[model samples]
Target: MWEVMSDPQSSLALPVTRLTRRKTLDQVTAECQSHDLKRTLTATQLTLLGVGATIGAGIYVMTGEAAADYAGPAVLVSFVIAALACLFTAFSYGELSSTLPVAGSAYSYAYVSIGEGAAWTVGWLLLLEYGISCAAVASGLSGYATSLLSDLGVHVPAALSQSTFQTVLSGANLTLTVGPRLDFVGGLAVMIVTALLVRGVQESARVNAVIVVIKVGVLFVFVGFGLQAMHAAYWHPFIPQSEGGFRYGLPGVFRAASIIFFAYVGFEAVSTAAAEARNPRRDVPIGIVLSLVICTAVYILVASVLIGIVPYRELGVADPLAIAVNAMHEPWLALLIKVGATVGLCSVLLGLLYGQTRIFFSMSRDGLIPAAFSRVHPTLRTPWIGTILLGILVAIATATMPLEVISDLVSIGTACAFGIVNFTVIWQRNTRPGITRPFSVPLGGITIGGFWIGIAPALGIAFCVIMTLPLCIDLLRALGNGNPLPAILLGIYIVIGIATYFAYGRSHSRMAQAPFDAD
Candidate 1:
């Protein structure tokens, strides 16, 4: 990996345009900038941003599902495998944070360092990863809300909560259908996050930190209470039946790794907050690894308790934790867990939205998308337009959908981006000898950071691409007679991105037009 960049200066991005020196880009460009988003986040605030952006239905709900359907009590091992994989990739991120410390996460880094086309495509993918993924998160939050309401004596009417088809079917059986409703809770959370982010990164991060505390507190409560009911029997035969011998003499860990992979979603968010960090070199790496480690530890521990309390067969379902508590004859605890889930999801939605808007901000700045999107509001200092646009779209998704499709899509998208980060770090390491590094791998012997992060990306891309083809074929076949517009729209999104880059971004790109100069 270290051999790839022997003479970076020869191939490195010489400043494309001589905009100015010793002047932060935001200040010089602020006047022309499309958005008013402020940069006030500190290291701690960024850490909380990492924390807030991290958890959601993945842990509270998906854990049991993994245990039951995929891994069983050995799901804890699955969590470990996934965490270790992320740990590897995060190290590469730590290296990049020290070197580039820019916003746009990996996309921005790729653009300025790699070339115009790479940046544009990565930026497009980041949108799918962060923006669409957040929408997916909001949808997941809505599902959790329904489960919470059911725990209480009061339940939502089916017409409000269930999908139109589910409601129709249930109504045929009984006079009324009980269902999960779509309150604006998911949408409202996005709004609140937008407001905070609008206020400034510093303030928003502080608020996010507080929310993270609550979310973590909720997880802890579950862990502590759930631990009381733990039984070791669940740990027997950790690796269940599998197709081949792999990873641990059984492919179970790999299978578990894929299913539990989404649990580690928030790790990349540190890269997103790179611009606001005081010391990107130092803090970005620290925050990324620190947060990933802490979260992984928590996940494994909590998973252990979840399995200990229940058998593997019963753990694999949506909202597994609540379902587990329901089994303990402590339905009331499940109710609280349900309510806690609602609160935890609040932080998840807000954090994911915060990340989504920033990606657009970077893309707009780079001239990838319409420069109009980069504009800041004069008074609010936030990207009000972009925030509102994303908010509405995500809100609608939350109102009318299930978590399955979106969740898988997000995981696949995220994995693709993750793979890129790993390779980029390796590319930089081999080429840029003088590249400044703020943080390095916690263990610096051989560079494994690239490989660790690369696995998920590999797995994600392979799986998603594989999965997408079948879905597309089915969708086209099923909807040929009906409105088939959604399928058509998805095709247009990518085409529009490629078209926009060629039509506009290419001409305006600093790399293409400006001369090299050290900033």
Candidate 2:
């Protein structure tokens, strides 16, 4: 949370009033006064937006892998665990979105409920979460793109599948390695998302709607068809201990939950879309909770069906969906699923990019980032520059970096965000009770304060830290000296944020000395 720097003489941002900004959090929220875009969405549209964001890429790929690895047929339990955690955080998010409907999504909410420092931290982490998610989805799209090319008997060398520093091309000499291919397809997907968003919010939301429907339909078909082939015996030992189940009890489930947390990443994307939402007060809450329920149900059913049809060990880490279908002797079905998966992943990329741009928009408007980045397109009504620039950066990273590293890193960042959100909710309920709150946690409104909000996040952070330890030790051992790269990156971002805070946000913040910017 931000420490309020005392400034007796302060010039607040324009057109805001009433609530005095004696703190950094108040100053960060001044842009609610300068909202250029008007509400154009309905509650159902908001709910669909959540669905559109949640149920795409993860369902296609991650479910099968999670099923095979941690819970065997019981990976359904893992999905349940993830959903439970999300429900708790969504409660906090929904309450905030209704109370403060703006472009910032969680970052904006954080600024209002927590402080400028927390908002900055969430904004920076959001870059890693949503940005990396978009890149990962783009890469997944490339897998389909390459396979489609192969189908047409025009296979680009795998080396040319993406872009990156992998292939050493010295003019007339091309040395191919297992690095980045020329991921032209991933580039195409990014361009498509960029163009759609540039068109307008309604246009982008509608496109996302269509994508969500088709993707959800594909999942339904897979589950229904795959169910017919399920053997009850396959679920013989439901939690299938020796058959890929955990010997160490809940540890296996928790580990799986941590990894499976990746699937839940984009569900929060809906909360970020609250800016374009017509009825954020009503719809934001409905959209977040409903979409999560739908995704969780689909996830549980799919995981159950996979283990019933195939042995856990046979279901390898790579391409478990295709492997499961193949094991059922349905080559035609397998081929079809690949097509569906590739297409569905496009929506995931788009949704993730949408989330990233909005978070950037929130930060820029708050003076946490450059003011230039806060400019909404006079026509598009979106943060076009932030969208396009971030896209280019992601294109370069995913095009070149290996999938495994990207996947793992994204998981870490996303999990951290979840922990913070959970804690932020509890903090607001307990510490900042004077603020407006339209929705709330049920009961222990004391217990929630005590256990769910307070204790859960503290432990969640500890768990994430423990997971990070292995990575830290590995990096240190690999270099034989603790690599300064990670520390340096963290420090640089923090320093930049501190500079931005003091330079612009400190003095000119409407909330600094005057009221809010409700202009």
The TM-score leader among the candidates is 2
Instruction: Report the C-alpha lDDT of model 2 over 136-209, residue by residue, as the tens digit.
Output: 77887787767766876877786667666443445433343564356767877787787787677788777777
The best candidate in terms of lDDT = 2
lDDT of 1 by residue, 168-258 (tens): 2232121223355564555555566666666666666766677778778867887888877877777787766654432232455555566
Once model 2 is optimally superposed onto the true structure by TM-score, how far is the C-alpha of residue 217 displaced, in angstroms?
0.8
lDDT agreement with native, every candidate:
0.63, 0.66
Candidate 1: 10-residue stretch with minimal lDDT: 165-174
Clash counts per candidate, in order, are: 22, 13
